[model samples]
Each structure stands twice: as C-alpha cells, then as structure tokens.
Target: MPDTPAAPRFRSGAGRICLDFMRTLRLRGMDGATEELDTPEALAAWVAQLGPYPGGTKIPAPAEGVLGEARAVREAVYALLTAARSPAGPAGCPPKERGLLNRAAAAAPPVPVLDAAGSVTWTAGDPVGAVLADIARDALSLATSPALDRVRACSGPHCAAWFLDTSRPGNRRWCSMETCGNQAKKHAWRTRHATATAI
Candidate 1:
C-alpha cells in the first residue's frame, strides 16, 4: 500500500498562542500571502500540532463554519495586536474588532484533568475551538500586560512574524536562531567576502 503522506509542518514557538496563530495567514498584509487554514482538515491539523493533546491523539476535523470562525478569530487577533503595539496602543482598536476578540476570549478553553499518577492532561469538548479560545485569551492578556513592550517583529528579510523578545539585552532580531539567524550570518559573511575580493 502507498504510504500516507505527512501533514504539513506548522511554525511554532512564537512565545504566545495568538502570535503563532497569526502566522497561519503568512505574510499578512504583504505579497505572496498564504492561508494555512484553508480547510476544515487543515484547521484540525493545526490543532493537532499546536493544541495540548497527548501524543497520537487524532483531532477530528471541524465543520466548515468552524473554519470560517477560526479565520475570523485569527484576523481579529492580528488586528488587536497591531493596535496594541502601535503608538496609540490598544485604545486605537475600533469596537468591532475588539468585540470579536473579546467574544473569542470568552470561549471555553481546554480543561485540565489529573489522573491517578498525578499526570495532567488537557481535554476539550471542541478541541479546535478550545485552542482558538486559549489563543484569544492569550492575546487579550498579552496586549494589556506590560510584557507588550517585549514584543518585536522579526528582522528576517523574508519573515514577517512577530515574537516576544525575552533576551536580557532586548536585542533579538530573528524569530528562530536556527533559521533566520543562521541565514543572516551566512549572508553577512558572503557580503564581507565579496567586498574584500572587490577591493
């Protein structure tokens, strides 16, 4: 039998659920924009990859309506963070987007259950929606918290993602050192070599 193909790998470790979800719409407001959650199956895949489910847990695909709502919530999250990070701050957000974000934040996130071994596992009646709810709530808290100042857009030339700069010096520039930072170092080396050769 033919082997089942693997699901596409999604990016993670943006320091916040909302920031990670925001990347589903890659290159937001920029050229070559791509939608990662284009279908219900894709939405389920995201939840399976990012949600707090145990290993090998199968995340059932949500309804088409749920996919739409997920996208809406993602946009609302982006809008809210944008406003909050701007000079005017969260107060600059108009009421409509704020309401959407607030409603999403109000959703029931995954609940924790402790087994006899004292192991904790997260459960949710609607896993996809629950993850999205956690994202919304995270965004709401992050936007209002003093940690908002720590948020920074990645300096990678090809990257448009944002991340919380937890570095003590507050000088982080890339989303992932393994990816963007390494690429930058190579580029800088090539440029220096070229300049030396020309001289």
Candidate 2:
C-alpha cells in the first residue's frame, strides 16, 4: 500500500481562525505556491481536524463544488485580511466574495454543544459549510475589531505568513521565533563574524 501524504500543519499563531485558514496556502515563500487543501478528501480531513470537532465524529463527504467553494473562500479571506493589514484599511470584501461568505454563514451556522466535561464547544451540522461560516465570521470580526491593529506579517524574506503581535511590547516581527527568528539571528551572527574576521 502506498504511504498517505501527511496533512499540512495548520499554524495558529495568527490568533484568529480566519487568518489560520489563510495560512493553508502552501509554499508561501515560493513563487509557484501549492494548494494545501487540494481535494475534497483534504478538505474533509481539515474540517475533521478543526479544534471544535469532537474526536472520532465522522464528517460527511463534501458535495461536488465544495472544494472549489472552500478555495474561493480562502482566497477571499486572504485578500481582505491583506488589505486590512495595509496602512489604509481594507475597502471591504469584494461583492462576489462577500456574497459567497454571507451565503455560507447563513447555511449551517455552528451550534455550541456541551462536551463530556460540561464545557461548551461548537459544532456545525454540515461540517464543511460550518467551517467556512466560522472562518467568515472570524474574518469579519478581525476586520472590524481593535485586534486589526495587532496583525503583522512575518519579516522573513520570501515568507508571507501573518501573525498577531500579542507580545507585551507588541514588536514581534516573525511568524515564529523558532523558525524565521532563528534564521535571521543566525544570518546576522554570520555577517558579524565575517566582518570581524576581514577587519
């Protein structure tokens, strides 16, 4: 049997579901970007892995066009958030994309369910649509909330990831300290040593 490809790791540092959804765009550092959610099965798997889903709950197969819709929604959310991060706030989501999100938001809204521990957790009746709705809602909230001011794109060259600056001084510039931050530190250290040796 062929080995199954590993699922893309979803980064949650963006501090918002919508931003995390946008991170699904693979190879953000490359010219030829890959689509992480490339198929219906991938979409189903993503939905199953979302934080709200109960463990072992069998998600229904996505209907035809659902994958396309998901990609469309993802792009729309990306564009809107990118614009919002700019000095000038986003003009707003394009009409067609907004309509797509609104429709999804209206269909199969997530409901809070009580888990075995009696804590409230959300679940959607139609997993795909519900996930989209939750993402749409989160995007809208981020666009309108004060948290918009805290959103920052990674400073690493070739990296296009965004993250929320939740640090005390609010000066964070990388998607992660372990990845881009470390790379930058190493590069600076090498440059300093090279200059010292030449001198």
Candidate 3:
C-alpha cells in the first residue's frame, strides 16, 4: 500500500504571531531570534520572520521608505496588549494611540510565495499583526462584567509573558506547557524529594 501524506496543520494567523511575540519577550534576546533595537531593515526582517512559514516561502519585496511604518505597527500591537492588562489609571489609550492600533489591525495579510516559474507556490496566509488583533478581541470577549479583567501577563517570577485565558476560572498563568508549567512541576518534585531525604 502507498503511504498517505500527513495532513496540513491549520493554524490561525494571529495565534501564531501572539505566540511569536510571547516567545520573543520571554527569551529577551539570547534564546530566540527577534527584532534588534538598531537598524531599520533588520527590524523589518524580524517582523517578517514572525510569520510561521517554511524556509521555501518567498517574501514579498519590502515596501519603499516605510520601515518606520512597519516599526510603528509592531509597537502598536505591543501597546494594545500591554494596555489590555491594565484597565484602570493610564491603562486606557487615547484616540491618537488607537489610530495606530487600527492601522495594524487593518494591515494587509501576508502574501503567498511563488515558484521560480512565477506560479503560485507554498505560502503562509496569515500575517503576525492580524493574529494579534484576533487574540486581543478574543481575550477581551471573555469578560462578562466590568469586574472581570481582560488580558494578563504570566505571573511566573522569571517570565512576564502574556496569554489569553479562556478557562472557566479565568486564572491561567504559564505561557506554554513546555516552558513554565513543566519547569514548575520539576521544581516541586525536586523540593519534595530533597525534604524527604533531609528528614
């Protein structure tokens, strides 16, 4: 019998970007590839890299003289996620601030890559910013009353990563299972074993 091909995993665009941003923030620099504070092209490339595409995906030519705009887009999403966490005081943003957020929300979706013969080829349909918009909307939707807060950063002391908690309790913490939760369990087990040995 001939082998069947594996099914393509469908991932929502915003979900991928949200995970990328979380991964970037958690590691800061050394752990993963992210935007550098200096250089426009590098920053733009970093933003582009956030897309979940295979290496064969062809990137569209960068827009002319709009590196600043790309940077603004990245920062805008960052601000929205940050603001969503703090509802009171200076947490709520003004109209001018929201203008950028809306721009990012409405930005064009990522283009598909073409083959050498100019035919349509493999592609990543979702853009990073688009995913952030969806994540923010869904994150906020969980709130049933004014008392229910929207959005939250991971409470793990070493990791301040953000995540949308759709749990019934609305008390989720760790950003990912492979990272914080596993680490916490390992730490607990070691502590328990150590105490038993000491006694």
* Best-fitting candidate, scored by TM-score: 1
1 against 2, candidate with superior TM-score: 1
Task: List TM-score per model, in order.
Answer: 0.94, 0.84, 0.55
Steric clash pairs (candidate 3): 14-131
Error of 3 at 60 (Å): 4.5
Q: Which digits, one per residue and each the tens of the lDDT, describe model 1 over residues 1-199? A: 9999775479998888889999898877788889999999999989998889886689999999999999998888888889999997988776888898888878899999999999999999999989988988998999999989999988888888998888999989999998889999999999999999999
Ranked by TM-score, the better of candidates 2 and 3 is 2
| Top-down lDDT ranking | 1, 2, 3
* TM-score ranking from best candidate downward: 1, 2, 3
Q: What is the C-alpha lDDT of each candidate?
A: 0.89, 0.78, 0.48
Clashing pairs for model 1 are: none
Which ranges in model 1 have alpha carbons more than 4 Å from their true place? 1-8
Q: Tell me the tens digit of each residue's lDDT in model 2 across 1-199.
A: 9999765455566777887788788656579777878778877877777646776677776976998998888888876776676765666556777677667666676789887988886777687888888888888778778998998888888577777788999999898888889999999999999999999
User: Which portions of model 3 miss their true places by more than 4 Å?
Assistant: 1-19, 27-55, 60-68, 89-91, 94-96, 110-150
- State residue 180's C-alpha deviation in candidate 1, in Å: 1.2
Question: How many angstroms is residue 117 displaced in model 2 relative to the true structure, after the best TM-score fit?
Answer: 4.1
Tens digits of per-residue lDDT for model 3, 1-199: 9999643222122233443343433334345534442454443344445443454444454444444555554455555555544554224644555576555555454445778888753333434344444433332332223332535555555665555555679777766556677888788899999999999
- TM-score of candidate 2 relative to the true fold: 0.84
